[model samples]
Target: MDVAGIARIATEMTDFSTKEAVGIAVLKKAIDINAAGALALIEVIPDNSQSAPNLPLNLGRNINTIA
Candidate 1:
């Protein structure tokens, strides 16, 4: 079989898609953020970086270290 055919088989079995795997990979990477020191990001999310409003930061301090 040709190289393309082999790739198709591989994608269909284990990858996201046999056709749109590239797009899926891109999206997964874009949204696959770490749960450490990162807040939940939403689309069209308000950019609080421009103002010092009275918004309460929900972040916690990891004080279990022996520093």
Candidate 2:
């Protein structure tokens, strides 16, 4: 309609676009941080399977059902 109203709408649209871009950037950063943390956790896990290879294969297969 009027030039002032058009200007206000354009400004509001620009503000919304900027906010949306910042939100997306923040989300990507958060995802990257979480992935790094997960990788760190995976790296810290002890590799116990290799430590006791000589044990019998059936050792852990049996469950003691008698309470």
Winning model by lDDT: 2
Give per-residue lDDT, candidate 2, residue 44: 91
Candidate 1 residue pairs in backbone clash: none
Taking the tens digit of each residue's C-alpha lDDT, what string does model 2 give over 1-67?
9999999999999999999999999999999999999999999986656657888656676899999
Q: Each candidate's TM vs. the true structure?
A: 0.24, 0.75
lDDT of 2 at 55: 83
lDDT of 2 at 65: 100
Sliding window of 10 residues with minimal summed lDDT for model 2: 46-55
The prediction achieving the highest TM-score against the true structure is: 2
Off by over 4 Å in 2: 51-67
Model 1 CA deviation exceeding 4 Å by range: 1-19, 34-37, 40-67
